[model samples]
Every structure is written in structure tokens, then in C-alpha cells.
Target: MRAVACVLFILSLVWDSVRADNSISSLKMAAASWEGELPCKEWNCECAFKQRGCCCAATDLQEVEDQIFHKVMDLSRRVFQLGDTILEVLGGIRVAFTASMSHKKTCFGPFTRSTPIPYNLLTFNHGSGYNPALGIFTAPRPGLYSFSFSVYSKVQGEGEKMYYKVQLMRNGEAVVSTWEDNREDSEDSSSQTVLLSLEQGGQVYVQLLSGRQLCGNIEGLNTFSGALIYPTLT
Candidate 1:
């Protein structure tokens, strides 16, 4: 009877060992078979353990998913904030090309031989009134930009002479100014170019300064043109 009992005990222990081994093998197979749900696959020990651990593993996976979702939401919000800031900066621009005229009186070209000049000739308060005041322009945008001006004058004896002055102003303050005083009456046209860093709602103008005994004014016959160039937001 004692021998019979020993045999039965041995059989029971062997059966339990086989059952444990089968369970572990089954967990590993399940882990390998699944390829879509988790961050890791075939070689993932954690996944295999989770498969064997049932409820405990499921809880861990849920926590990880929640964390990932929150991280994505945070990144999305950051992107939106950055876009809003860019839009705000773009909206602040307010620079534009306002007025342009010449001495021709007819507003046709920059050169003409008419009196009672069409456009106001810039003049200084000095005795000779030799120097001219700058023509006023307004800024359409608040940013760095480029601008250019052209002037044509007609000499009394010869023909057409051109002289030009360009200036950039910010809040009524002069930021840049350029002058060309070529006295050759034969030249039909003269121009000046300027690059400026300006703020929104700023102003600019052009002025023609007289040199020696020669007096000059902007030529406006049939048409006169002035332009401001800038880059629009992308």
C-alpha cells in the first residue's frame, strides 16, 4: 500500500510540471502570433509575459495607450499656437504705394514744358527756396521692403533735365534719403533706389533740391507713377 501511494504522488507531480510548461508555451505562441496591436512583436518578452499574465498585462497596456494619446494632443496644441503667432505677425504689415506725380501738368510722362506745375515742387524754407521738401508716402506694411523713385526736369534753354531725391520715413522720422544732382539738361530721366526697414503705418516721401541757379520740379505730363515693393506672407 505504501509503494502504491508513492507512485501516485510521482505521477501527480509530473502532470503539474507538464501543465505549467504547456501554459508558458501557449503564451509565447500567442505573443508571436500577434503583430498589429503593440509597439513590439515576435521578440518582445514583455508581450509574452503579458499574454501569460492576463488582467495585469491588459491594465499596463491601457495605461501606455492613455499616455501616448495625451502626448499627441499636447503636440497638436503646440502646433496650433505657433500658427496663430505667425498669423498675428503677418497681419501687422501696412505698407503701400500712395501718390505719384510729375511736372508735365497733364500726368502723362515725367517730362513736359507746361507752367503752373501739376505736382507740388518740394521747397526749403531757405532764402533761395533752393531745397525742396520731400513728398509724403504711407507705409502699407510693417516690415523690410524696397522702393524706388524717378524724376525728370526740363531745362529752360536746352531740353529735358532729370534730378531725383528719395527718402524713407518712419513715424514722421527720416530713416533714409538719397539725392542725385546731375545738371545735364540733355538727360531726359534720373532715378534713385532705396531699401528700407519700416514699421506698419509708416510714411515716406520724395524731395527735389535745387542746385546753383537752376530750379527744378518733378515732371508730370500725361502720367506719373510711383511704386512700393514688398514680399507677401507665404
Candidate 2:
């Protein structure tokens, strides 16, 4: 169990480095920071779950962490190939992104129906699946993916609704939504996130309701992002 903890600690180092790059790296940090402490520094070394081999899983909370650690290991190995260092594995092995509307852009839409919202400002595009021109994310591979989007709008006039609805869709199907409609405020914002199972070439995107609007400035208030959580492939 301690060995598993140590392994997670090592992987966390990689996870910590590429967090800004993709979803998988972000999850790596989570794996590294999981609430388990490695009792042993060496892999396969006998570990004391509590006290010198006596910290038996039968009498411990730490063992729960132990179980989680092993799952983390299994997940990591699933993402990274056997014998590959975590960092090496991240080079093209992980997929993720965080992007936003251009700081210069003012609004998304007032269309009749929901339309694809293009996020032209890209803070990160680790997998290069997100298209700034089209406002679409085409999955690069099959896996479990995480996605999130935020919508914000400014009250432009007395009649302009301060809130709007934004949907995050996978393969054209709505998975979740962000609706911000506060008349008392000059600006309203909402965000939604979801984890999904996807196949290669799958697509995910954000759509703005017709006549509704999402606004952002150079600060980039409206954003969209996602990352590969775990590869389904062995």
C-alpha cells in the first residue's frame, strides 16, 4: 500500500507540471494529492498500513487511502504506457484544453435557435482538438472526457435580459447547461461541467440560445474547457 502511495507521489509530480495543459494532467495532480501518505519509499517494499505491518486494512482509515492510491495507479497506467515516465507519457499521451471568447469580443448571440458559440481565445489547447474558428471540440481519441463552460452577459439595455442560457453539448446532444438571468445585476454569469464517455472523433461544443447573449472583455469572462479523464483503450 505504501508502495502505491509512493508511486502516486511520483506521478503527482508530472500531474503538477502539466495541469494547465490538459484534463489528464489536471487529474494527475488530483492523483498525486489524494489523501494517502506512502508508508514506504520503495515500491514492493513491505508497508505498515498503520504500525509496522500491523496497520492492517481491517483496522484503518489510511487503508481507504491505500485503496484509492491503487486505483490511481491503475488509472495512471491506463493513461501512460508501461515503463514510460509520467512526463514522457504526457507528451501526446494526454489531451486537454481551456479556451475563451476573445477579449475583444462582446457577445455570442441573439439568434433564433441555439448556435455553436466560438471561443476564439485559447489559453491552452494541449490536444489541438478545439477550433477557434468553428467553436467546436472534436475529440482526438476515445476516452472519458471532462468538459466545462461558463456564460456571462452584460445588461446592455433596459430590455436586454441580464441572463442567458448556454448549453454544453456532446455530439449535438445537450449534456448540461449554464443559465444566468439576474435582472438586479448589470452582469450575470453561470457555468456547467460534465464528464462524458466519448469515442474517437466525437465532438463537444457550446451553444448559445437564440436572442440570448454571452459577453466578455479582454479579461475573458466566458470560457470553455475539457480534458481526457481516462483513456478507455488498454
Candidate 3:
């Protein structure tokens, strides 16, 4: 019985030795199969037989990180551009104007048709929105605005009819009017103030009605003015 037990133990050792030799042979064959082929296409890698997948994983991870970095940089650039655009829009929102008829003592006419009264004297034009030559105030932006106009006249002789009609015009339409048609006063003056909601490029001005004459404007009292109350942002 003792001899038989010793023999069984020896057989077990032999079986273990065979299994170890077969495992080594399998590993050698796998190495030989990948001897000429690269485990990773872009980088050199020394991989063990069981760890061959480790080579391409690191390269792939690096590529993914590079892509993520570029995406972040692009997003940052877009945000900066948007900020600059907002600043430019805010900087352009200013409007104010004050102007009057020419400083020289003069009379504005009785024309066959209604004519725009040219205010050639510029007191202040913050945004260059008022044009003296054209006798027009162009709105620089959408906003509420205040406008005022004054008309003054003196008849050639006492008891003569003081006949005049002047209107504040918006886009060729009358918004307000001031006139002196009665003979009670030899010289007369009138003024009007109005609040207007304007869009970009809207125009406003003063006009003399047809067959109406204004005189005795020596003091630059005949004036037109406007200012932006507030901007409407959307």
C-alpha cells in the first residue's frame, strides 16, 4: 500500500510538468504570429502575450483627448465673439439734437406749396442725426423721443393780417401745428412740443404751410430740437 501511494504522487508531478510545457508552447506560438505585425499602428509597443490589447488602447485614449481639447477651444472662441458683438451694439445707442433757423435775420417764405423749414444753425448734434442742409432729423435707433419747434413772425405793417401756419412733420405727415391768422397782434409767435415713438431711419422736421409767411426771426428764436428718451431693447 505504501509503494502504491508513492507511485500516485509521482504521476501527479509528471502531469503538472506536461501542462506547464504546453502553456509555454502556446505563448511562443502567439508571439511568433505577431512578430512582424505592429500591435498599435501609430506607436511602437512592447506587449506581453496576454496584454496585447494594451497597445492600441493608450493611443486611442490620446486621440480622444486631443479631439476634446479642440472642441473646448472652439467653444471658447465663439463666446468671446458674442461678447464683442454685444458691446458694439450697446455703444451705438445714443441720440440728441438741437438746431435753429439761420442766425441771420431773415424771413421764410410763402411758397406755392408746403416747404420744409431748414434749420441751418446747429446748437448740438450728439449723434449727427440732425441734418442742417436737409432740414431733417433721422432717428438713429428705435426709442421714445421728445421734439419741439418754435415759429415766430412779424407783419410788414400794423393792422396787417398775421397769416402764417407751421407744422411739425413726421414722414411728411403733420403731427402738430402752430399758426397766427388773426390781426389782433402785429407780431406773434407759437411753439409746440410732442413725444414720438420712432423706429430706425424715421424722419421728423418742421414745415411751412402753403401761402404762409414768417418774418422777424432775428433772434434765432425759430428753433427745432429733439432728444432720445430711452431705447427699446429686444
lDDT of each: 0.43, 0.73, 0.77
Per-residue lDDT of 23-78 in model 2, one digit per residue for the tens? 65455455444455544323222233223443223345576888999999999988
Best by TM-score: 3
Best by lDDT: 3
Residue clash pairs of candidate 2: 50-55, 110-211, 111-211, 163-180
Q: Which has the better lDDT: candidate 1, or candidate 2?
A: 2
TM-score sort, best first: 3, 2, 1
Candidate with the larger TM-score of 2 and 3: 3
Q: After superposition, how far is residue 56 of candidate 3 from its true place, in Å?
A: 56
TM for candidate 3 is 0.60
**Order of the predicted models by lDDT, top scorer first:** 3, 2, 1
lDDT of 1: 0.43
Q: With candidate 3 superimposed using the best TM-score fit, by how many Å does residue 128's alpha carbon deviate from the native? A: 0.8
79 Cα displacement, candidate 3 (Å): 22
Local accuracy of candidate 1 as per-residue lDDT tens digits, 85-141: 998765443333323453443322233321211234432211121112244444454
